[model samples]
Target: MRTWIRGLVLATLLLPAFPACGQGGDGTRPSPSIERPSVPSASRRLTLDEAQAWHGRHPRLLLAADDVAALRARRATQPYDRIAEMLLRRADEHMALAPADVGKAALAGPDPMPHVLQRLAMAGLLTGQRDYSRKAIAMLAALGEQGYPRRDRSVAGAGDLAVGLALAYDWTYEFMTAAEQRTIQRQLAALATEIEASMSPDGGTFGKLAAQEGMAGHHAVALGGGGLGLMALALRGEVNYLQSNAWQTTAEACLRAYYRDAFGSDGAGIEGFELTLRALGAALPCTIAMRRMDGVDLASATALGSVPAWAAYELLPGPSTLPAGESGGGLGSQDAMALMFAACPDNAAHAWLYDVTHGSRGRASFGRAAAGDASFAGPGAGDVMTLLAYPGERADAGPPALPLGKQFPSAGLAYFRSGWGDPAGDAVVAFRCLPRPHLGRWHLDVNQFTFHACGWGWAIDSGPGWEAADGEPTLTPTVGVAAHNLFQMDGREAAAPCGRTLAFVDDKAGWGLVVGDGSHAMGVTTFRRYLAVGKRDGRPRYVVVIDEIDPAPAGQAANGPQNPATAGEPPVHQYRHFLHTGAGNRVDLSGRVATLTTPDGGTGQFAVVSPPEATLKVAEIRTHAMGTHPRIEAQHATAGRFYFVAVLVPRAAGDERPIAVRPEGRPGPAIAFRVTADGVTDRVCVLTTPEARPPNGFGKARHRLQLSRGDLTQSLLFDLEEPGHDAPSAPDSAPGATPTPAP
Candidate 1:
């Protein structure tokens, strides 16, 4: 394939120019004088004969003739009417502004010209407004003439310019003159050449790359494949360049690789929430265009089938997501959701995500001025793609029917919630222990977790590591071990390691647990974290966290002298457990208990039950540009193995429920605790040894857990040799069945 493409490129480059199609050999009918527009020196203008031979249909990229007619027929309908009005208003706004100078250096804010051009073109197509089309053509001419000098700044910038030009050209094709079409084709050809160069092995904006690896990252997949590929599709038959076929083929390959590598099998983006939306913004549109134009169903070949569910799970109580990687938390774009619905119209979850995040009557409208207000739905409300991809009408099923907890094993992230759709009543927890290789925007935050309840982010991540203030970079104290809720050994940051999930069990009756092996992350032989959430009366009540650490392997004396600096003395490592709270939250420490109070008057009690001699303190840490926030530090030193058992309980503003925590009797190398809240007492026991047959009630087991409350008891067995075990049925419960709800 490579050889054939290379031959085609070489053949085309060596070919001579031909006369106009209608002109005879003796030049009976003279061709119209071709006026070449001022463009970059490297640009090649297609001759009149070449432009005349290129065959293409009008409005072929995103909309067909029949589809455009349907949109016109539905212009007075419910959703379409609202969306059409928004587009017309935006197009009017675009008419008042001048075309951007593409030759200037890139600015700090996002270039709005692309979206502005898209809106103008779409409005003209839907309303048959000559004014809108003419305005869009003028902008298109300016873009083609100036040739977007900043397109080489980043793949994203290049993609934006390519897509803007592609959409304006394709949608407004019928309104453009022969000369305008010729000029636009030359600019598109030049842009395609630039994009191909960036993906080459030689250093470019994207740096060195293999063909497959070039499309592996989310940015490349989004901007390179989806963005630039859309241009190739729009220009495939219209351009004389043979490299157009190679670009299209590469774009399709990028679609497949994006699903295979960029996102997990469970449809979770590795870079977290913000970039996920940005990538899908292009990828989904490209997928829709391919299906519409070529009858190819690329969405079926990828993890897009599960993306709606993943998006639903990532949404927290404040309608925001966790700052997992480089993201600042917010709801995903409505344009992406609309595209997801277009790809999977039969999927109720996708339909619901679209309906719930819709511009007018969705949760996105909360805390905003009014229904049709621009800020209510963010910038996506004004996007033209949302209108094109909108599925007419469907039932909006709430998320209650979906599972309360979901785990993306490929991405090594887990999300658990108590209920759905009730911001004030729901409790959410996000856990990360990525076993896969960490690269490109991923943080060294393995075994980290965040907590949210009562409409407040109780435990939070430190957000992105880098921030710029007034054009100068400012380094924050939040990075690596300093920014996460994990333990550090001997006051030294451990090397980033691949953390693994040992077991996961969700009863769907408000009881669930996830176990992770993070020994390498802690720089120890054994460091396992057991995290669980409990609900009482269909509401979230408490969360339990138990950490077990051992510096030596099994059958070796952990207390033996190992450090050269302390000869003949028992080895001891100072361990510190850290927990950061949300901004403006107050933390008070008393004995081993730390109480957190949110500005909304919600309260959370954090109690450390193990390591009797441990000390707890609260100090302020600067978390990027989010300002100073309190972080709880728990310190303990041990010569051998030890445990850190803690319980967190979240209470609503006025719901004064007494909470108590007591340490239970340990059975061998294990820790047990009993937590009582809301008139229910639950006891939990976790085994820490590699293998044990202690005479205690746990019996013969390793990596075992036993929980009992009232007449119900649950036991889970974890096998280290084989991970990914679902929670096993308790002795009193049916196998492979959900636990019975408490009366």
Candidate 2:
């Protein structure tokens, strides 16, 4: 885990508990409610009768004899050779280290004894070295004498120790003496019992409710699925049959719920990046163990099979992810990717992502592979799991199999890019409009967006929240609307029921658009945002954003908190459209244009072309956790209705092209704009209201857009009220215009 996550965990533990509130009709604060999927009958608990008849041979936890033999035979190959040498070197390093103090380990590092023992045991099995096996046994015996994990500490310590000890014991079962084996088995059983007890309703850190609803928190996987499951598998026939069966049954139930509810149908983790990686890492051990010991593939029955693709899409141009929800802004564990690849060997995109992120020893040309000054040489590199899970003689499939844009409807996330494979050249945009807040981890900035272009993240999300070191009651601004690139109404947080994606159109011709309704998120009558990405001559050119906001009727109840002074009078809302840039970048505001300059000399201009009365202000927002960053706010106040049109152009260094942006078309119910740069002129028109249809003959359309560049013109129409209504084909072209149907 990273330092930020550790801090978050500590802060979460210390924070005061808030009242359990329901969804408020006033839209000031709403509780998150996730509709969990029904558990499949096939995932039901196995009876004690069936478990007693089950038997497993030694070394069947993660590796069989054939697997080890094949690994040894293929040790001369590329990744295999590198991985084998890495494991052997790690074993040598462990030979000099002393057993961890379980009490101290629980508070900070957690028990390292299990990891050390696991590495030594695997090295022994691979090399047939008695010294490695002897060291592992000695460490196991030393740990057995101690109180493995102090009961007063966090349950995570117990969970980690269980996983590590179980793996080590199972791998080295044949090497230990009879008495030593008996002692280790007893310790493993005790660890399992402790973990199970921690999930009890009596005094458990994670209560029984968490076990039933796996997505209740991360503890379901860390404690119930991975730790408990692995320990039970290791002690199956060696311990009391009923005790082992009960542990396995509970572990399987938790895992089933976790795999089903924790992730969306598209495999996007609802809890965001950091927690997802942590959960996946914890779940991998038991997933592999079950597959090897019982011939059951839990991942195959759930969305785990699609996780790699979702992960691939979440990755931005650099090391960070989209940072849509709660995140620490780093590419987490590669071991999870290794395990996913082993289970899904034929997914080309997965292979490409794994190779680009972890194939090399140091940083790859595109993404970060290892930590600073860290080599893939020790147990810290996760050499054992990598060696076991990495597919032999596989080739990276690259980006040909991936689409230029994708939309995960279940997660309400859409990503569009200009191109692929080259981080420095591609222009990417991520838009999020989840139905509701996900376990308080997701921000209130629904319809939020992040943009990356010219090798720099210009518009970014504020990851995690501020935590005061002194334990003061500090505000977490990052989780509020001010920290995201979106529109905020009356400076209030979102308390609406949900945000909906009204329409999505991704064309193969290098232009895409996403329309989202965030009225509920902003607690307004109507709030829709239209974001479009355009490419000129097969290269990223510009992005255009159109925002429409309409306040609720005078007599109607607004979504957020209303002024008490006004009482029942019509409310006047102050709408602030926000845009954020990295702290290292410099922002200069001139009239309606905000020019951002990167440290590497890259430049991007955000020009507001509509609502001529809007004012632009640039300032630095300082937070305790994320430091200081530049923020651009387009302030506009209106009681009736309003809309905004902005164009963003990212230019590489030394590209001195004059860009022109201006409002287009006569006054109407829609916002129209044109952006011209580098001899390419792009025009966009967005219909703001569905009831008050525009006079341009766009009949009965709930959402309508017209995009034109050169001689290609595409018109998209969507009727959000009618589900699964196929959009009509485009009308015949007029002169130079070639109308293309909506996708």
Candidate 3:
């Protein structure tokens, strides 16, 4: 365990004993004697009834001897750097090592001991190294002498250890001697009991309900909250290296808790993007292991195709949106994980998963022959899993194409795209609207957007809120708010557990709109922002943003920047719109109109079309705090009821004249205007009163909100709040019924 975990454990024990908390009678750490009860390994046995009940479970852990043999045979004939080859190579290398050498090396890592040991045993078996497998069992049994060296038993610490041992025991079952099996069983009993005690209701010196709770006040329960239950399921009726029933009751209860409290029925993850990904890493193995070892599917606990949705949550498009080598972000992608994860039992999301993970290393590594019969010098991550379960060449190719746009309601992630599966000029926007306060690194970017066009992230929001640390982010002190494309009031980033999507709609005309109520996130009385993705003749033409804000209630103090004055000039409220850009970007300014030239010779325009009172300026800004490389910032400030509108259009730099955007006239809470380069015009009319009611008309193209002047005359009743199809914004207009057919 790291020092931090010790510190956290210490914190819980030493912290205040609040009223009726978890752990003990008054929320204090329970006595070790009471917390962990003794369980002897000698008397335990797997009854015939118990064995009969779980009869359907595969006799092998995951891969049987036959599975290993097949892989080895393939290694000899099928030569490649693919999945099968990777596993076979590693297992063969393990065969070459002396048992003592393997044991000595297992203890060398910082503390991936359980992982290392499991690797040792599985690889040894594949290569028929019985002694090597026995060595791993011995070293692991030694760990039981202490209180199981792994800590943080609840989430993953002890859980990881337990899983590793379980895998080792199952995979090396046929090789272990009776004495070795007994020793391993004794170890398993002690470890399993300890893990159960950590989260048990007796509340070790602490309050019964207080062992572990929500970290960020937002989550109901934290990650690995379900790990204990998963461990119990896998360990039941199994000891050290043999199957047995020891903690069946606890396992069943914990599994219930996992579904009830941890992830719930919906397959949404709350602990941010990367951590959720890690949680998936832990979850997939456990679920599959349960199926392979216990005959219990635990299919309900699966994330149900959440991987792709999580990827969509990312603002940038690439192999992975996570910043490479960023400690807090992620380790790396594991293809087998993604493949199996994508191949859920539902098969509803199979095609999509197949498409997304096709090019990934894990996917690419499977079932192929390479240039050489070469093996690895050492074991690799998840090699055993690859050999145990891999898709052959007979799987379906994939679905026809990726969706043009998608909305993951649980993640509050709405994705807008202009034909990503088609041309290279595709555009995408990851618009984040946290339906509730999502406290963590991800929460820092709620109501923020990452825009991509011309094959690159132009407006990027793709890093941790705090790169140097973990947990809740400090927006003002870091590149928190500045890292996203959002509005600034008194210079603080939009607060989390903030904003919710009021409406998300896409038209067949290649236009999409996402409306978010950002009042809570911005710490304001009333705030709503409309995001519009428009296309011209089948290509990404423009992105329009309409922001309406009321900083605070009458008496609340609202602090903001003021326009520079000539000695003694009165202070004026300065509201600003900020944007962070790609690596190579050129900013061209002409009063309120700014043209952004991207590295690939694509140009996008940001013109303030409404609330003409606010002036604008574009600059390539770089600060020691923000970063060394420059980013784009468009500053805006105006008086009266805040109404800001802009058309951000990215297109080929040499294309025809860009669309002209300007306030129509005397724009009200219900009116705005725009004229496209094709001479077609649009009038935006919004009815945003508390008592306002919308006319149910717009079906699919509700997001575009494309209406003519005469259309507005039909009564300001445009209600595009939920799912709809493209009809007409007003029952009388049909100009935008058909999209220009993605240019």
Candidate 4:
């Protein structure tokens, strides 16, 4: 009882009301009281009569679980380091020591531990055995007494206690005589009175909907708590217990706020992935319960990503793209949790539970073993547990593509899907560039990237820990936009620059973009495109194109004698390009394209080719030095060197892109290419001008001649003109033209 109380307090105090519901009582329906229905817990899998009935109608209905032995066994063998094992051991010992009292269940972390006990209780009930119920109830009572403790708030104790009580009510409801129900009622009645002390105007009082510690780590907890609270009531089934006016008020407040304000109108999870999963997983059950009693449907709640996080985790494997860690932008243990979550019921909600099972240690500690011993291996095995799932349908039409918010930040990443399912395929493909290693920030490099496919990360970003020979960047910045291959300016490095200057600015439109201002140029990448298709003509191709323009050149004062190597007047105009590759096999840069051909003849390319029949024409065609952030130079003018990525990706039919021809005789899927003709050139451009003379009588007349203007629209117009022709009023193109390939 003590433990149960503690757990409830901890969970509630950790996070207050649900974010899915808004705070005010607009036209939205009133929130309902939390209630639970008795559910059986049995060793053998059995569907409840109610569950079957719901599934018959909804088809996508997800029933709650009551298999304690199975869940316990699965949880037991999960790989745990010393700290995690100690906590589990302590929980088990405490449960054994006070088997008669339900208060000891608080032995585990406040928010998560009680859920474990609730699961055990539900399983015991389904087995029609009093022994399991007795043990479970005692654990809850013990937990209640101890009261979940945290350095922060004590109300969270109420949350864990709530879950333990709900599970007890849900699993033991049928067997409990009226007197037994009273015993449990007496325990919970006292806690409900204090809930208001913790409620915030936004439903975040006591930290529930609030960013607990911060928006980045465990942001999901805010949303996760609401689902747990609802689960407590649903499993309990005691109308008297759920009908408490205090509990009902909290539920109403939380629900209204969640839908109205917490999530965006378009469903974006501003708190990022952690909260997104937590909210959705808990919501599945809450939505179901609410609709059954009060006619409220939260199924349409939007904060969900287009493809769902688990699906992406099962499919892609790159370090988080977000600034948290270098391993890729997603939650660290997402891979393992995504796999484990499949069996829980609703695929998306199941994914959230999978991660939560890792407990206080965080998802990085989650492992395949936690998913049970069924051996989840096969084609798309660990990737997506679609065996009992529904395919997503686009609201508009066509195959369901992930929404832009979901797709872009999560786009073009390669991750290792290492758990169950087919052993033959081990790799996942995300066709976007990775940030180069030496860049200071974690911003995706404009042109650098990573590729995953065929059970391996073939074309990949060199991780950021290399040590330079002379205390400089051994590789590109592990941070910053220049680490990626979107584009560059006057050869200046983005993030940190030497010869030139570049930086990334927010996009007024819904996307994130890069901005560059160099010694001789200023340019902005206006748009970007990522394309992927089955190997066309037997070639596997993924292409990314960035559209950029430099509307003006730098003033002479900014460029004048910055250094000896740069002493000569800057070039009138310059365009630079960068092409990175996943397959290091064989690469070539020619005309307006960069191509990588696997040893088996499969290919991927970067190119600026005519896209069917559009009125726009491409002109100036040439290849120059590899474009990238500044680093040590072999030659005074040359900085970074380019090389084709080496032997990777096997040669196999149905896995390669089909070959095709272009106007320049270039092969299919250009990895990196550009053309600058008379109008709207596709090549990356860099421009420079002398600084302006100070206002004074001694200023030289030639200082006025240093002015130059760079125009992006003009550059595009230039590309439309015929090739082999020079700009109408400019000098010939400058040196360093070694047409290389993108590897």
Question: Which is better, 1 or 3, measured by lDDT?
Answer: 1
- Model 2 TM-score, 2 decimals: 0.78
Highest lDDT scorer: 2
RMSD of 2: 10.8
Write one digit per residue (lDDT tens) for candidate 1, span 1-743. Answer: 01000000000000112222223335465322211111111113334454345466768777776688877877788666766777787679778756564334123224355666787888898898888998888887776677665534577667656676788888888888888888888888888777766654453534242233312545555666676678876886687546676666556655555656556456777666666776676777677777786667655645677777776766666543333333645455555666776777687766665555553425532122222332222223334766676665564565637777778776677878776665445688888876544344546677778887887777777676533223345675344675678887786775654566656767565366776766656556666677877665445567777776776643233654465665464477787888877778889776677778888777777777777667887877664534567788888887776677777877667755445555544334555554555545554555554343223432323455564432223356422212222211121221122323211
Using lDDT as the measure, name the better of candidate 1 and candidate 2: 2
Q: How close is candidate 3 to the true structure, as a TM-score?
A: 0.67
TM-score of 1: 0.78
- Tell me the deviation in Å of residue 263 in model 2: 3.1
TM-scores of all predicted structures: 0.78, 0.78, 0.67, 0.43
Name the lDDT value of residue 94 in candidate 1: 70
lDDT of 4 by residue, 624-687 (tens): 1111212201111211111111112222224422222222222112222222211212221111
lDDT of 1: 0.61
Q: Which stretches of candidate 2 lie over 4 Å from their true place?
A: 1-38, 42-56, 73-75, 100-102, 109-117, 137-158, 198-219, 319-328, 360-381, 466-478, 496-498, 537-540, 551-575, 621-628, 664-670, 689-743
- Cα lDDT tens digits for candidate 2, 1-743: 11100000000001111222234444455534444455654344445666555444577777776677776776787667766776677568778755654335433442245456667888888888888888777777676677675433456556666677787777777888888888877877887887777654443645354454433435344445567888888887778877887777666666666777666567777666556665666567887788776777766657776766777766666542334334644555544656666666687766666665565511431111332212111112356777777774345466646676788765678888766576556677888877544452556767888887777777877666653234565656467777778877787776643476656767545467777777666666656677877665445567777776667732233433567876564557787888877668889776667778888787777877666667788877665434567889888776666667777777766765545554544425565554544444444556644433333322344555565532223356432223332222321221112332211
Q: Candidate 1 — which residues are off by over 4 angstroms?
A: 1-54, 100-111, 144-152, 200-217, 319-326, 359-361, 364-382, 466-479, 537-540, 551-572, 620-629, 637-640, 664-670, 687-743
Candidate 4 deviant stretches above 4 angstroms = 1-112, 149-165, 174-199, 202-275, 301-314, 317-450, 458-743
